[model samples]
Target: MSTDRFKDLPIHSYQSIRGDIQTGDLLLCSGSYPVSKIIKKVSKSRFSHVSLIFQWVDRLMILESVESYGVRIVPLSHYFSDYRNSGKPYKGNLYLARHSAVKDLVPNKLNAMLRRGADLTGQPYDIEEIVKILASVVIDDLTSIRNDKYICSEFVQECYKKAGLSFQDDGRGFIYPEHISKDPSVKPLYELIP
Candidate 1:
């Protein structure tokens, strides 16, 4: 893996990378909050929610492009903090997935379901954690958005809403928006995320 272009890509902590190590394993890196937040922003915009999901699907296509290589990529559940605390570089059985797989996979009918699984079930999901969850999710829709460039963000939002526990916003600095507020509509800052 030439990591030259991705040198800037955040290196997950040693613990985060270690637990998922497997020789020849493909690594899936992603975030939960940023994804949903972006979706929300797109939803609030004039563009249809479908257009937002389409954009996200396009991004997923870029992130998950490695699957095209025929390598099975997997998601990691540990936090980058765990990896960082471990104080070691990932070695032994981990590989980064192709960029396309990261961004494009979500658009496929088969993979879209997998992405939904990640968003909904990625408990304790953070940036690296979400990636790992997504990696583990099985792709069932490969052609849903093949011809179309837009996906309905409504579906994606529903997935995030279902996450219930486990999922957290992975935006640069933003935590859960609803969590910070007291309003019922506002998410609580901290909840029992399984």
Candidate 2:
């Protein structure tokens, strides 16, 4: 919770922070995109996006469902660079969160979660579901439209469920980045300022 650890580091330090990211860690982010702005407004939360981290070979990669690229695995470098180019004054304003119960997870369960995320690679981003989510926010309905595709937070929730850790179960698709961030089981690791 201390801002002291969230220093304004150069872009190159993103790689150093990548070393600290573990598989199944959640990368909660605040972005400058239009949809991001709307999500923040609706959720009333600073974070508008979330990605699950996984180790691939020698480096770390993030599995996320982005509107532009859909569900995909990208190197941590790409994730950081995208934020750096966002034109936001506070680029890379991200917080890393790890489930407090992760330490108690067996290796198989962790691997299952990673595999679940990996299985969704190349899936399309659910734009319709996003609209429904936004509409629900406006109406205060909180209903979700289940679909084959995924948005960011729902994908993360599914991965955690596969890993045997279930946090919020407002049915399957009714989740947002704020919901995950607010969960008491998820502990903040570090925040990258600017």
Candidate 3:
């Protein structure tokens, strides 16, 4: 694919960016995949994946549940580098957003959410849940599946719920990344362009 496909899009450098991204910021991505395409089409949104950010020691890390890796912590630099090395800008494009209501949360509450995510590291990705989510989209059902496994968005929703931030219900465990992006309480922070 050609970088020209994304030439007109705004680009921002991670190194040149100002200000600290506090813990609990949402990292949204327009992933390139058949599944991602379906998600974008069904949700009528550009985002396909969502991750939670947390400051781990001196570095910022993303907590996300992916089909291949399940729940894992990836350094922000590594995440950005993946896009830079890929050459295709749109494949790597990512947006950072924060829960508009999280500003009211005390430091303790924010830390609690981060801790909850950290504690879940290594859990297997819920492949079955992904199927259920896709099926729900096709059937126009918004019901969330009850399961011990987690998808990226479901994990994020659970973290917020643990921290006492309630997003509009989209079934018990069926929240999509688009759901998080569309929530009135989320505000875009920055875009990482190639």
Best candidate according to lDDT: 2
Q: Can you tell me which runs of candidate 3 are displaced by over 4 Å?
A: 1-11, 83-90, 140-142, 171-173
- Listed per model in order, the count of residue pairs whose N, CA or C atoms clash below 3 Å is 53, 0, 1
Residue 13 error for model 3, in Å?
1.1
Candidate 3 residue lDDT tens string, 89-117: 44646877788777788888888888888
Q: What is the lDDT of residue 101 in candidate 2?
A: 80
Instruction: Give the worst 10-residue stretch by lDDT in candidate 2.
Output: 1-10
Give a tens-digit lDDT track for model 1, residues 16-82: 4343332211232222334543433432221111111112321211112111121111223222223
TM-score of 3: 0.83
Q: Candidate 2: count the clashes.
A: 0
Query: lDDT of candidate 2?
Result: 0.75
Model 2, 77-175: lDDT tens digits are: 665555435633334267787888877888899999989988898888988877877787666765776667998998898889987886674454477
lDDT-best of 1 and 2:
2
Error of 2 at 105 (Å): 1.7
Against the reference, the lDDT scores of all candidates come to 0.26, 0.75, 0.74
